[model samples]
Target: MEPRFLLMADVAEQLNVSASQVYHMVRSGELPAIKIGGRGQWRIERSKLEEYIERKYAETAEWVRTNPLVEKDDPDLS
Candidate 1:
């Protein structure tokens, strides 16, 4: 049996983006998906979606680490 897949609208709702953005991701291969029929039907695996989110968070964390934030005001010396 084939694994379940999510529709573009549903995926966008979950990701808080527009369906067009999802389509862009599909085109760029950032989000793994399979198209069915000639009507541009796109489907994504649940596991792949979760993995993508995790990887994005990891990249964000690494960026913050490499570029640390600084306070404008200096604290009192102890």
Candidate 2:
């Protein structure tokens, strides 16, 4: 069967972050995940990962809107 969930390591690889950082995000509730199996393995749902990426994009857009870019060398500005 096809896979529906991703391991913490997999998520870390996709996010280009360390597994420890992913663990921290999960612990801080910044990312949604679940612990399963006897070893309490962490699993991130595919859809939830996608949602997190989309949310981050939206948040970055909002931040850029609030903080204008000031170019000191721009002839139009100065």
- Residue 27 displacement (Å), model 2: 0.8
Query: How does each model score on lDDT?
Result: 0.87, 0.93
Q: Where does model 1 exceed 4 Å of error?
A: 1-3, 73-78
Question: What are the TM-scores, per candidate, against the unseen true structure?
Answer: 0.80, 0.86
Runs of candidate 2 with Cα error greater than 4 angstroms are 73-78
Q: How many clashes (backbone N, Cα, C below 3 Å) per candidate?
A: 0, 0
In model 2, the Cα lDDT at residue 45 comes to 91
- Which window of 10 residues has the lowest lDDT sum in candidate 1? 69-78
lDDT per residue (tens digit) for residues 1-78 in model 1: 745788888889999999999999988999899988988788988888888899999999999999866665436432
On residues 15-69, what C-alpha lDDT tens digit does candidate 2 reach at each position? 9999999999899999999999999999999888999999999999999999888
Candidate 2: pairs in clash = none
**Model 2 TM-score?**
0.86
